[model samples]
Structure formats: structure tokens, C-alpha cells
Target: MKDNIIDARGRACPEPVLLTKKGVEASPNGVKVLVDNVTARENIKRFAKNSGYEVKVEENGEGILLTLSR
Candidate 1:
């Protein structure tokens, strides 16, 4: 399966979540979302979990990487 990446870093709130939702809907395999803030990271994780996708998070110096897989 191919992985789709959504770069949401430097963006605020719902924008990241919205981009992630779009990416998830467009990609059958999975989506990787990059967010620089805690709020965006948590929001995306919550959104993905509630949408029935398996969520994983990785912390980095720049930001967090959220992996949403079905």
C-alpha cells in the first residue's frame, strides 16, 4: 500500500485536521500528517481515531508525525 503525506506544519487548528481528513479520504492505504503544535497533533489523532483509523504518533525536533492507517 502507498502512503500519502500531508504537511500541516506551521498551520493552525482545524486546517491540519481538515487536510488530514482529505488525505485519509483520498488514500485507501493510509496518511501521514505532520504538525508542529501539540493541539494540531492531538486533534488530528482524535479525528483519525474517531474515524476508525489506527493512529500512531512520533515526536521529532521539528514537530510530530501522525500516522493514520486503516
Candidate 2:
């Protein structure tokens, strides 16, 4: 089930959000955004929500996963 994961770990601010935007635009189905920090998680979550997508957060040894779906 893991697919199109945008790894934004160690990235700051707009970078994560920009990557997410590009991912979303590229994939109409949805995407999984992976972030290491809470700030990145929150920013990506907000960006996903504003783009009219549902956000599901998951924590794992790898990092924080922000799953975005239509």
C-alpha cells in the first residue's frame, strides 16, 4: 500500500509544502507525505487540507506519514 511517498524529512518550511503540492498535482489519486518534524507534519497537513484533500497522520520508525486522499 505504500506508494508515491514524498519524503520531506529534514526539510524546512516551504520545501515540504512545495514538494507536497507538486506530488498532489502529479498524482490525482493521492499521495503519502513523509516528514520528520512536527512543524513539517503540521505544514503539510494544512496544505493538504486546503487543497481539498483528507489528511491521515501515522507515526512510524521511519518518520511521520501524512497520507493525503481525495
Candidate 3:
């Protein structure tokens, strides 16, 4: 299935991860989370892993893109 994208740049700590988690949970397929910080990227990855979703990450310029799939 296709995925959705969420731009979470400039957001702090749990906000980025929490928002990403919510997006993934609400999606019918999966979500792609975009963040500008390493912490946000790691946190989102951990959240996906903990929630049992497949995750992939890519670094684009100064941002991180996280793909979450079931």
C-alpha cells in the first residue's frame, strides 16, 4: 500500500515522535515522517520498532525521512 508523509520539522523531542506515531497508527497503510533532527529520527525509529512496524530511514540534506510500514 502507499504511504503518507508528515512534515515535522522544527518540532521538539517527543512531539516529533508522538506525531509520527499517531500518523502511523491512523494510517490505513503506513506513513513517512520527515524531521530535521537526529533525535527526532531516532525516536521515530524506536517508536516504529517498538510498535512492530517496519521502518526505513533516509537522510536528505539536513533532514531525515522515516518510512513506517506494517
Ten contiguous residues with the weakest lDDT in model 3: 20-29
Model 2, range 28-55, lDDT digits (tens) per residue?
6699998999999888888888889999
Scored by lDDT, model 1 comes in at 0.88
- Tell me, by lDDT, which candidate is best: 2
Q: What is the lDDT of candidate 2?
A: 0.90
Q: Candidate 2: give the clashing pairs.
A: none
Give the winner by TM-score.
2
* lDDT tens per residue, model 1, 1-70: 4667789999988899999988977895689998999999889988998899998899988689998888
Question: What is the clash tally of candidate 1?
Answer: 0
Model 3: how far is 69 from its true place, Å? Answer: 0.8
In model 3, the runs with Cα more than 4 Å from the true position are none
Model 1 residue 46 distance off true place after TM-score fit, in angstroms: 0.7
Ranking of predictions according to lDDT: 2, 1, 3
